[model samples]
Target: MLDFFTIFSKGGIVLWYFQGTSQIFTQSVNSLIKSVILQERTGSNQFTHEALTLKYKLDNEFELIYVVAYQKILQLSYVDKFLDAIQLEFRNKYKDDLQNSALSSNFDFRQDFDRILFEVEHAAKKQIQKGKVMKSFEESEKSKKSVKSMIENKKEEPPKKSGKGKENKPVKKTPVKEQEVKKTSSVPMATSNTSNGELDEETIRKNRERLFGPAKKKKSAADVSKSPKSPDNNKKRVKVGTKWVLGGTSEDAKELDYTDGTADNLDVNGVGVSLKDEELDYVGRMKGELRDVETESESEEEEEEETVTQKTSSKKSSGGMFSMFKNLVGSKMLTEEDVAPVLDKFREHLVSKNVAADIALKLCESVSAKLEGKVLGTFSSINSTVKTALTESLVQILSPRRRVDILRDAMDSKQKKQPYCITFCGVNGVGKSTNLAKICFWLIENGFRVLIAACDTFRAGAVEQLRTHTRKLNALHPAERHGGQQMVQLYEKGYGKDAAGIAMEAINFARDCHIDIVLVDTAGRMQDNEPLMRALAKLIKVNQPDLVLFVGEALVGNEAVDQLTKFNQALADHSNMTNPRLIDGIILTKFDTIDDKVGAAISMTYTTGQPIVFVGTGQTYTDLRNLNAKAVVHALLK
Candidate 1:
């Protein structure tokens, strides 16, 4: 039996519902709305909540969602058909009210719902009853004879040897004529391709040779000792290019990564910030002119300018898929079949733009769901309609859910005599430290005192490099400007210390120094590195940074999902707190590298639902820019 059946609008109006049990389904139903309906994951057939199985169907035209819930232990085959039946019946009964956009929950649908539900369930029961066996007298004890008697009946006609005289001689193989009769009566071990199913002469010859073949003889030890052994036999063979050698020197140890402890004896790439002071800014550039991010395009006309794609151009454009729709003549409602081939090509086009395969597929599903039943206008083709829907969906995903005003938030934190801490984390070589420097510059340019937290003690020599950045940033804003105090300070506990403890101490130190903001720099670690990820989670959970930024490369494609998901999952799993601080936002770096494949922006945002706060377009701090969703979507579609 169903626990409940509900009809509700997307605007949270419950039209009508029936409850068969007293159990509260409010939590389960609300969760479905928030996590699925609101999240745009409606392409799924069913959703499970604890002990209940929830199946839903969407009526997009009326913005109605019909949900039915039942116990998972029950095999409710009639639920789907029942939902379809009831939806049609209810829509027909209230067709006049719904078409007029009546926004009331007093819908009279109970009688129609019950009648359809009963009919559907009865039909399902009849179909199930057909496959069931009937217990009768023929299936009783006499039909199941005793084991001994059943075997005794067959024993009387036991095997009769072909000839009594030949049986006494112990004949193994029969004559070819007798064997020819054996093919029909017995299963053949070797099969033949011939129509008669007889073994070919060559097959028969090979079978005879295999069955009566002579065994190979082993050489005796005494005979082997009589002859001298060859030198080639004594010298064991090994792979070429791998000549045996003595123990290697200490210099060879340098090849191994020394992530922890002192390595004075080995030549290594000294760790800290991956970037140098020289890369932060060239000596020729003036430090007085502070440059910030560009939220919009450089030219004012960038918004007004439209990019026209010509179908007849000598160089074929991304309008390749658009041209295919010309053959799909006539205007009508879109079906799954009509849009399947077009969406498949659209899916590939998204993947080509560096969108993750799974993300691209979900986008296509979303597009198909939105346009599945909508009719194309006389002037519009399937091509224009699909393109517009895709553009809107991409823009929606990229749009920030809430404005991230870091300047205002930092100022607010300063008012409370507390530092606004921002932690930077990502896999190795993604330039977390460099981007941190860029962010630090932005904060300082806005006239805020900053503390550099060197929590990346896992890297043996990484602390000093961040110190270099600290010195350069302070040099840009000397002590003379801020009451004889350096605008930026570096707090490092050297290598091989607990990053969590270091960040806690740094925040405390920032409080004491009256620092306006704290920038926590952690060691670069791969997403799959559990120990490091645990340490990262520990730092975030302990410090509870105002904003935790995940730095990623623009050049990354499918790896973007794994990197972000695992990083977020690691924070949630290992934090051990009720509410752990997952990544708050993303910092996409190397924006200058990827040309038109701006799909990374969509891929990262869609994976986490976190806005990309800062985009790193170059090596210098001034290269930072805010994410322009319009610009990114334009590039993606083009």
Candidate 2:
């Protein structure tokens, strides 16, 4: 049974919904399904949420149609058929209403859909039951047929005949007419014998030969032993005019006399017949024809070579003229009209790669500004020129303005007798705790003391997760260290406590212990959650971390832009400072999953004006890699 079903307009407005389960659960499911559909719409049209067993479909008009089930259902065909029927009926009934936007408020579908809902439900139930029965019956029939075939084969094996002086008589073959009559009869036939109650191989062979035609004859031993004719015996040698003629000793050979040499002038029906003397004449003519062919081929080759040289020279002259013109102008400039077409294509490409439409437009505009009146020297074509401009622009935007040197900053803080506090924040499932652990590992590997502050009191296992990471990292002590094994310390105030207060306490403890850096792990919060955002802003305001880096997934595309923007705004507003605390840098997670849709990294950085310091390539601690602008641009373009 369907747990929930929903219909959405092309613009993602929910037009109708029916829930057969808890309202809260259905709402959550609907939100998740909407997010999945939105993401799919950017790249694909259909996707399945395996966790919820929800199936979604988008019609030709871009209307979203979806259904949810309690568990995995094998008979999905019924659901598809039902959805098609509903969509057709709705479109047919509300053809004018759907087209006119002003009619949406007045249109009521509740009463009209009752019949359709009932019919679809009944039809789906009957189809599902019918499918199950047919599947079971087919299995039973297959098993029965297999068992009967095996028993029949065992019973058909003839028993060995006893060796006796009396020979067994051949089985009598049934007439074709009687065989047809027996086949039409209802009585069961015995498997041990034919209709005549006897089994014989000779009789079977004779009957088969009678029904079909006779076979080919086999070769005799004498015919197979005969040898082929020798070359010397097949021809007679005769000398004529300084050449010897090998003439065949057959009826066709008697027409020619080899000794006279008259065969040279002989024309057999205007076709050249080569005799001993005519062979020389034929050779001479062949040599003349070969020479003509060689001359023609050589002339053709020379002409092709000349054409290639002319083309190369023409290209060089054109290139030189262009270079001279640039030198005269004092610089190569890209006019607005020159790159409009190329920029349009590039914008489309970015959008097709799942980059946000607005961001893509802005990126194109930025590229256009950067390219206009810019020097172009030795560039090949408009395509390469635009590519170079875009690559440089992306690299400029992606390059971090403020360098993130964690070890250097921590060391400087250590020398000053204070712990450098760094806080990690982002929405849920962006790997906040995991990335904090990775940074901790990096600091320790560089021979610096690290402390993990478990200030994420909201999540149930947030503190435990930090403790696990600390335990695993503490085990990997560098062998070159002169002192005892360096271990990471975790400070947790347990769940349901003031997170900002705990972070402040952890900072004080780190200062007392002379720790190099204190990595604060904040609870994952959604950007749209005002309460949580305000709480996060309070934590940041109270603690005032040296580095507040935003961690986001690279597969979220433009949504990451919205998230970072809202997060930055919240922090700026609630921090209660004249100049709001800004995100120092971004740490993008899941960089390996989104193969072609990697524009998220560029979009996030370009939108926030923040650099991506490190990208999490995999789940392991060692999977983190320093971000390079060229490498990122290459991956995106590739």
Candidate 3:
């Protein structure tokens, strides 16, 4: 026991300490055991230990605790009578209710003695009553014993002597000689049967017959019982009744392969799977596994379904379609008044621009549907395919009309003296250069003299990539490279030493060369930086470009909108650009790669009232699609 305690104490999971009075509440079994051994061995009372105690065994095995050396502590059992002694000693002890109650009620000696006595007394009374009931039974048993005793006494009495025995005793010995002669005569007759006499001939004939003919068939117990071995050859066959079998039908059973390598018989709902025996075995195992998988999947589906049903049911109980529809449409914070005028103006513009009203209404409905799953319902259980289709329908309706309005306004507000020059100026990787290249190809295809300015000189590949792109589209590309001093001088003429100067040079070159649309692509800049944004401001000041299209990536999420907002703020300092929200329009690049384009579309709406003018759907130059809102919605939803 001491060795067990020592080993257990070193295991680190056990906590040990001593407690007589002072540390009674803090004491534990593990601690008390350790303390006793330590005090005896060390001859010093300076050990303290604590065990990680639990109400139940932790991890199904060892109890956890912490034991450390401390000052002398008294033994717990030595604590004597005092007011609140029990309460203080057992304050945090492992005192189970039943054990504590039994101890306090004095169950150890008195209750056990009383309980045993009660049981013994009750048993003694029952035994006494049983003895009383059998008293009458003893008398009958005694009478039977007496009758047997009388019979035994008569049996022990001597037999009476025969009176005529004395007369017969005289002739008894004289008959011995006569008896011997009779025995000798009987012996010869007994021997005659074995000596092949008349009886022997009859026995020999029977033995020969038994060994040869007159053979009898050996019978089995089953034959005696008359049980048959095999079914009758002419008996009709019955169908095997199993889950996979069809009821009273001539058609063969269909085997199905399931997800888990188990196959099961699946009832045919439509077309049946025809398989060979080997394939059927393989499918049977697969179907069994699939059933397990489907069962789990169904459980999960049921949980999700219940959640949706509960939410829908609760909402339905609260109100009907109008209330539900109101909540659905109500997600858009713009009230009817705020949106109605916009819709009216949108309708008039679409009509003026030759857009069908049916297309416009579909766009509105689809937009509403997109918001339905997100804002109206507690559950996100909308069908993915249905939602995608609805979204596509909306984009198809809105994109073209919005594009027409933007392009028409840009054309109408054109500067007669100045050449049409637009630059996609923003931060790096914002799709600025890519959008410029795409729009240049667009303008060139539209019968315009388009010139692409490769003003992003920080990376050598930037100019090469733009030039390569222009070469593929058969459009003109203008570029230049300058060192720090010459770059500074160019910006002193009213733009920055960096992108601003390059953009200014590109704009002037386009004007002199009579390029209809000089699209200057700048290095991506952090729009949030006042210095970088001011540089863009300086470029616009010097070049006074007709349009400044913010080229944002379709995958840019809402960050593009944030940059657009700050860029507009800095651009306001420029006197040359009238709407320094020079966000004349937007070109959402890489539209093909985005799974959901609604975020990008809504971003454009929130940041710039301007619509997305163009989209780059693929890597090729001809992959650019004119951003018709309806087309974007249609393509994304589809």
Top-TM-score structure, candidate number: 1
- Ranked by lDDT, the better of candidates 2 and 3 is 2
Residues 60-173, candidate 2: write the lDDT tens digits: 333445444544544454565666667777777777666575334544666655676677778777876887764566567666676656665666666556587555666886
TM, every model: 0.71, 0.48, 0.35
| CA lDDT scores, all candidates in order | 0.79, 0.68, 0.46
Highest lDDT scorer: 1
Q: Can you rank all candidates by TM-score, best first? A: 1, 2, 3
Q: Kindly report which residue stretches of model 3 are placed more than 4 angstroms away from their true locations once superposed.
A: 1-417, 475-498, 573-581, 631-638
Model 2 lDDT vs. the true structure? Answer: 0.68
lDDT, candidate 3, residue 425?
A: 73
TM-score of decoy 1 = 0.71
Using lDDT, rank the candidates from best to worst: 1, 2, 3
Report how far residue 424 has shifted in candidate 2, in Å. 0.3
Would you list the clashing residue pairs of candidate 1?
Answer: 271-461, 271-462, 272-462
Q: Give candidate 3's total backbone clashes.
A: 46
Model 2 stretches with alpha carbons more than 4 Å out: 1-334, 373-380, 478-482
